[model samples]
Target: MTNFKITLYTDPVCAWCFIGHRTLDQAITLYQRTYPGGRHDMFEFIYHPFYLRNTKPEEGRMTLEDAMLAKNGTEAKVLAIKTKMQRIGTAHGILFNYDSKVGSTKLAHVLIQQAGRHRGAEVQKEMVGAMYSMHFEQGGNINNLDELVAVAVKVGVSEQDAHAWLRDDQVGAEVDELARTAREELGVTSVPTIEIGGLRLEGAEDVGGIMEALVSVKEKEIAVGGAQDPF
Candidate 1:
C-alpha cells in the first residue's frame, strides 16, 4: 500500500497541456483497467493551476499562426503539435480545435481557485477541462467572463459566486496566490508540468512510460517501508 500524489500543473490555453491532460487520463484509465481498484489508495492526482499568459484578456489575443510565429515555431512544428493534440484529445473523447485563438487564462484560473474553495477540488478539475475544451475544441475565448462563469456553473460552482469570482474580482487574490505558487514557489517556468510522488513529470509521456513510472514509485515505497518497519 503506497500513497502517491500527482500534481498536474497546467494552463487553460496551452495546447500541449491539453494533450498532457488527455495523455494522463488515458494512462490512468489504462492503469485502472489493468488494476481494477486493486490499488485504490495507491495514487491521488490533483490539479494545480498554472497561468501561461498573465496578460490582460484583450492583450493576449492572437491567432494560432500568429502565436506560432511568435514562438519561432515552423509550419512543420505547428502541424506536428496540431496532429498530436487532436490525436490525444480524440483518444479521450475530447474534441480539440487547434486552429482557434485563445487569450489570457487569468480569469479562468480565478474561477478554479474559487471552485476549489467553495465546491470541491473536482469542480476545479472540471473547470480546467471546460476551459481547455472551449479553447481547443470550440475555439471559444476563455478570457470572457461569460465563458468562465459557464464552466464554473457546469462544474457546480455557484453562478452568483462565479460572477463574483469573475466580475467582482473576488477571486483575483487567490488567483495571484496560485500563480505565485506555480511560478515562484514551485519554480515552474512552463506549462504542462506534472509531478508524481514529489518527482517532476514534465512534457508528454506515453501511457506505458507513465504506468511504468507509477508502478516503479509504488514498488520503491513498499521496499522502503519494508526496510524501515520493525515489530
Candidate 2:
C-alpha cells in the first residue's frame, strides 16, 4: 500500500521524450507483473515542462525539417537523425512523423499544469500524451492556441476553460517559472528526465533500465521501512 510519485520533466516536441513516455509505461507494467502485490494505483506520475526549443508563439512555427537543418547544418545529417529516430521509435510503438511543426511548448505546458490542478494527475498525464501525439503523430503545431485548445478538449477540459487558461498571463508565467526552476535549480538540461524515489533516469532509457530502476527504488523503500522522503 505504499505510494510513490514519479516526476517526469519533458517537452512535448521531444522525440526522445515521446519514446521515454511509452517506455516508462511498459516498465511500469513489467514491474506490476513481476512483483507481488504491485498495484498500478501505488504509483503517481507528475509531469513538468522542460523546454527543448524556446521558440515563442509570435515567432510562429517552423517545419520540423527546417529546425533540424538549422541545428545540424546539413540535410543529410538531419535525415540520418530522423531515420534513426524512426527506427528506435518504431521499436517503442511510436510512429514519428518528422513532417510536423515545431514551436513553443509554453501553451502545451500550461495545459498540462491546468489539467493536474483541475482534473488530477492521471488526466494531466493523459494530456501530456495527447500533446505528444499531436506533435509527433498528427503533425500538428503545439504552439498554436487553437490546436492546444483542441488537445485540451480531447482530454476532458472544456473548450471555454482551455481558451481562458491559455490566455491567462499569470498561468503562462507560472509554467515559464516551472520550466526555469527545472533547468536552473534542478539541473535538468535534458528532456525526459524521470525521477522515482529520489533516483533519476535521464534521456530515453530503455524499458529494461527503467524497470530495474523501479525495482531498485521499491526494494529500497521496503528495506528502509518505507520511510524514504519523497522526491
Candidate 3:
C-alpha cells in the first residue's frame, strides 16, 4: 500500500514538463529529509506518454525554432523567451536549454511506454530524465532513432532490448493507444499534466502546493483507515 500515487503525462521535448519533474523531484527530496524514515517508498511516481504532436500523424512535426518563431514572430522575441525560460529554470535550480531541434516525439513516447512496462517506474524516470537532458542539454535530436537508442542504452536498458522493443509494432501501438486515451478520456491538452491524490494538476504547478496536497490526502486516507489501500 503506497501513501500516494502520481501519474504524470508528459512529452520528451517539453520544457515545462521537465520543470514539473524537477519541482516534484526537489519536493520529494525535501520531504525525505524532513521525515528521514524511508518514507519515499510510500509514494509512487508514474510517467505516461503524452505525445503533443500525435493529433496529426501524417503532418510533419514542427521544429522548436519554427514553433518559437511562429509564436513570437521574430527571432528577437524568441530569444527573449528563451532567456526568460533560462532565468526561471535557474531560479529553481533547473536547466532549460533551447538548443535542440525539437521534432516529432512519437517514437520517444513509444520507448518511454516500453520502459515503463519492462523496467518499472524508477527506470522509466531515468529514461525520461535522460531523454530530456539529451534534447534540452546536449541538443540531441530525440526523434532520431539512433540517438534514442543511445539514450535507452545509456539508461541501462540494453541496446539489444531497446532495438527489439522499437521493432515491435504492438509496443508502438500500445503507446499510441495510451496517448489517445489520455487525450480523449483525460482531456489532457498539455504537458506535465499530473494526477496526484485524485487531483489533476496542469503545467508547472508550485512544488510546495503539490506537497501540501499530498500531505492532506495522506492524512485523510489515514484518518479513514484507507491507508492500506493502494493509491
For residues 84-104, what per-residue lDDT tens digits would candidate 1 score against the true structure? 666776776777655567677
Clashes of 3: 0
| Residue-wise C-alpha lDDT for candidate 2, range 60-142, written one tens digit per residue | 46877788999999889998999999899889877877778888888888888888888888888888888889888888887
Model 1 segments more than 4 A misplaced: 1-3, 36-39, 73-77, 167-170, 226-231
Ranked by TM-score, top first: 2, 3, 1
C-alpha local distance difference test of each model: 0.71, 0.85, 0.77
Where in model 3 is the C-alpha error above 4 Å? 35-41, 54-63, 228-231
TM-score of each: 0.82, 0.94, 0.87
RMSD of 2: 3.1
Worst 10 residues of 3 by lDDT: 53-62
Clashes of 2: 0
